[model samples]
Target: MLRKITSLLLVGLLLVGLLAGCGAKPEEPQTEEPAKEEALKIAMVTDVGGVNDKSFNQSAWEGLQKAENELGVKPGYQESKQEADYSSNLELLTDAGNDLVWGIGFLMGSQVEQAAKDYPEQKFAIIDNYYENPSENLLGITFKEQEASFLVGYIAGKMTKTNKVGFIGGMDFAVIHRFDYGFKAGVKHANPDAEILSQYAGAFDKPAIGRSIAESMYAKDADIIFHAAGDTGNGMIEVAKEKGKYAIGVDKDQNPDAPENVITSAVKRVDNAIYNVAKDLKEGNFKGGTNITYGLAEGGVDIAPSSDKLVPKEILDEVAKLKEQIIAGEIKVPANKEEFEAMK
Candidate 1:
């Protein structure tokens, strides 16, 4: 019985030792599951000019794509077929829980305002329009297109052989008015004796109208023409190419399309503006209920570089000096007729 009890005790001690050893074997380090990536959803609604217009809409779209690639965000877009689709398209993006919704042009200002009011919690941005009573969730982006146009106009004025320049506008709205006033201002700045002839197509997408206007301007002895009429500007460039006159492009560098005729383009850098706003939102530094003005100082507007072949080095250097002066508060570019006249 004693031997049996001793054996039982020994067996019990061995079992305890085995159990403790098993417990001490350090739990196999657990592999933690990776954190899931947060999805950032952004969207843009195009103006009536559509996405492929190679102008405003295209710039905005390019910005959205850039955000998607860099920030790992998902972006969706809706092409506006007509004026009536603006509200619906904005609502569609918001309803889908988009982090930001962008309205591409001034034509969608009313739609954006109404939609912003309806969805006060949603973040909204609109280009080329300033809201009077903007919501806290809304941002109005306005560009100093006049400043850029002025630079291009100076180029046209200097390059014109006939001492006559022409301007083709998309519409008679404030935005278009600013472009016209700026171009004329620059022309006068470069050549005080230069004559400027201006016309409006009354439509942003009518190429035929733009072509007809260009023909009329060319016939009137204007050797250089600048167009601010979205795709309609393409028509103007075409006319310049065929007639071997000079043309200034807008929104993007269109010098490549008509390298021989296109002297320069008023680049608005809409893509950079849109991208900056999106980046701010992504970084949690979004500022709202304000009007953001991007101009020559902020790299928001300028003449394109593709015109190196057409513009003389001395002219480009002069433009650079003017750009610096504008940035240093030594010179101011006007946006309206009164300011333009005052500057003149």
Candidate 2:
């Protein structure tokens, strides 16, 4: 009997050991949360104006910064020193494995077209110009700058005590042409007799030329000047402040830079467009091979309201009413020289 009991005890101990080994959970299956997705990488190739022109390039950089802050993405940029640098800069970004690359101005349109073809798998976004034939990986963003410029021009026409307004452009491109024509149209719309003098600096980054051109306009009795030049616009604003005349800004709300002279700014919201494209790309909803246009209706263009000190309350109220009309389709703003001529 003692032998049998000892054997039973040994058998029970063996059974308990087996159960414990079997129920040990197999080390929790060494499970992991399925490695997190890697962050997206984006790059921007700035136009000849560089990054700090306080215009389109600056706005585009702001958008890239926004993406870095909100999307957990990495951002990089390369500045193009000249037209020849466009292709090489794009190649550098592509070689760096950038998931998306942006070309920041109309001057980059041709380079973007070629780059898009060279890298069919990589995505590209171009501002201010849309390719007639785009690849599946390319997105073209165009703005109705004239719509915003017209509003600012109307304000200039109403505010000018000298009955003379001037337009200073960075270059003689379609983008600047729209600004010039739109300003003239707005002047005419507000006061049929208002005279608008226009000139182009021939270069977007030359502040000296901008200042010289503005001085000429001011000499001719232009009390208000609208500048679409990049850094050149800064020079124009500087002259306006020194001359104690009103200056209209472009691209962003530049009133803070020259508060005493900047009555208002024709805001292009370039950063907003950049942010939208980046956001869409991150969400895997990027739509390419198409041109996208942003207008007052889409909140893509407008006049900055931060210059209340320079723009009187009456003018602001009137501008607000016109903004509503434009959005409601009750008013159609001219966008080009032809449309402006028709309005005249």
The root-mean-square deviation over C-alpha atoms between each candidate and the true structure, in angstroms, is 2.7, 3.1
Local distance difference test scores for all models: 0.89, 0.90
**Using Cα atoms with residue i matched to residue i, what is each candidate's TM-score against the true structure?**
0.91, 0.92
- What is the TM-score (0 to 1) of candidate 2? 0.92
- Per-residue CA lDDT of model 2 for 1-344, tens digit only, reads 99999999999999999999998866555566888888899999998888998999999999889988998779899999898999999999999999999999999899998999999999999999977878999999999888898899889988999999999988888888888887887888788889889888888888889899999999999999999999888889999889888899999999998888888999999999988988999899898999999999898999996858878889888888887887887877777778777876
The candidate that achieves the highest TM-score relative to the unseen native structure: 2
Native-vs-model 2 lDDT? 0.90
What lDDT tens digits, residue by residue, belong to model 1 across residues 1-344?
99999999999999999999988967698899999978688899998888988799999989888988988778889988888899999999999899999999998999998888999999999999998879999999999998898888878877888999999999889998889998998888889999999998988888889899999999999999999999888899999989998899999999888989988999989999888998999899877888899998889999998978889989888888877877887877788888987887
Candidate 1, lDDT over the whole model: 0.89
* Model 2 worst lDDT window (10 residues): 25-34
